[model samples]
Target: MTQFTPDLASRFARIALGHVERRYPFKLDQVLLGPDDRRSPTELHPVFHGSFDWHSCVHGYWLLARIGRRFPDLPEAAEITALFDRKLTPELVAGERAYLDRPLSGGFERPYGWAWLLKLAAELEQRMAPAERAWAEALAPLAQAFADRFRAYLPKATYPVRAGVHSNTAFALRLALDYAEAVKDQDLAALFRHKALAWYGADADCQAWEPGGDDFLSPALIEAALMARALPAGAFVPWLDRFLPRLAAQEPGALFAPATVSDRTDGKIAHLDGVNLSRAWCLREVAAALPVGDARRGVLGKAAETHLAASLPHVASDYMGEHWLASFAALALETA
Candidate 1:
């Protein structure tokens, strides 16, 4: 199985470094209230202005931070430190917070970007290295902004977004749970767990209608992963047994197959590559929650290896996937 080796860490860090601040070829998710709202990515987002979109840029920082933590001696650590010191400042983070306060901005990046921002904050808060600690301090208000959004939004989310794209709620919630767990925010954790259970509880016999043409996530697996993260072993195991009743047989096999990306240069089609990678991440997470003697563990583990093989090599092949795929690769490898 592919591992989070220093060589892979260096490569992932290099890919993130290449584009965290590349301001062009950008896609803005802004609510233009007036003429003055028309602005460049850098102007609108002081810290996150690259990697194609705000959410991608956020996770790009997360990829660098996570790799830097795991491989502290990496040559890229200096550049990562320099970048965080220069950009992740109180003033810049406040600009990001200001964006959230704008009129009609309630949906700006919504749950997806909101969740990624918290995950980045969680990575920074895990250690007390001077740079990491300072970055964490600089970013606290913005992270709070997102966490507050979650607290406010979940009450009215009535239904979860089950799409396999950025709108997917399960993916966002699972990422947010990591932040909640890291910070020991029991209230936050309780809120997220309640929301997840309310949305997914009693779900059984997943049909696994998945691999949506432009999907970057496996809807079925992400739901399973979120439930695994939210519930206890005694509760989750039985729930999962009913959810994927034929897991031992690999039924609903759309999930076991890696998505095929015929055109990596097309931004939407490139999402299929992300599907392979993010699936690897989710598969491992679900497998980890299973009992050691379960046959599904080996099955899920092998599917994860196949999915990683399918996309890990293509992470840096094109600017489309190049802008963001390495982050997913890091998630999969680090989890593995």
Candidate 2:
């Protein structure tokens, strides 16, 4: 599982195709400025109204696009292309972008959904096939909308969110950074880099108090992953050392250990599964950032392997998790 094989990619692709358009049991992140604000998910987001919620739906698309890119000849690729063709047209995507203009929509999905949107945009932007290019072009406006949101929001953010859930600033900025780099938006890239360092540069000796009741992310590992991508190698190692100073000894046993998912039917309880998957992602990112032959590399790599093992099996276990968990699994397995 160190690298995604064709079969693994197809499996992940099939999982995403199962739900990207299954518009039911949706959780709407809406604001009611008036009576008309009570609209259905598809009405609010034509292209991203499936897979449980908007953010999850966006990441679901990311997973499909990623698999399509990495394994173009997989059997599931045709269905993925058809899904993109049907859902990513200008008219549909415009509805998705227009949702942001509502009076009460300023914070529709905030950083979590915002990050996933940009992540989808970035993946599409990298595409080479004709269909993929059109998908990117069709979705460009929506991507820019979120990117604009980031530009306006970051300047006034002032402080970082250290949560392990949707509002986590580290996870948002890390994904947005990829989008920024892909589109060659130096201004946005600079903004992200500056804000990221300003928020996390001095952070040290993180207590690693994590894996909260329903957390789907590792606040500790994600922060380190952001710093790893944000800072230069020369500076990143020192920052990482200070951030997780006891990594060699695995002192913060919480980080090295995977979370226990007692139940997957409950949406919140299901997040622990995501915690394992996302931790594996961040763990791999951080371990890759480490210098060659570093002892911490082995430690982090081992943790990542075990973490993936804990959650990868259940990516399609229950509708509560199946709707979105595959995206995190893709993140964990595809990066390498």
Q: Model 2: clashing residue pairs?
A: none
User: Highest TM-score, which number?
Assistant: 1
Candidate 2's TM-score reads 0.98
The digit string of per-residue lDDT tens for model 2 on 1-336 reads: 467789878888887888888889888887777887788888888988888888888999999998888788999988988889998999998888788888778887899989888988999988887867999999999999999999999999999999889999999999999999999999999999999999999998988987899999999999988988999659999998898899999969999889999989989999999999999999889889888999998888889999988988898889999998888988888666
Q: Candidate 1's residue-wise lDDT over 1-336, tens digit each?
A: 789899989998999999999988899988787899999888889999999889999999999999888898999999998999999999999999998899999888888899999999999998786756889999989988899999999998999999999899999999999999887899999999999999999899999988989999999999999999999668999999888999989889898999999999999999999999999999999999898898999999999999999999999989999999998888888777
Name the TM-score of candidate 1: 0.98
Candidate 1 worst ten-residue window by lDDT: 125-134
What lDDT does the true structure give each of the candidates?
A: 0.92, 0.89
Q: After superposition, how far is residue 189 of candidate 2 from its true place, in Å?
A: 0.5
TM-score of each: 0.98, 0.98
Task: Provide the lowest-lDDT 10-residue window in model 2.
Answer: 1-10
After aligning candidate 1 to the native by TM-score, how far in Å is the CA of 62 from where it should be? 0.3
Residue 39 lDDT in candidate 1: 90
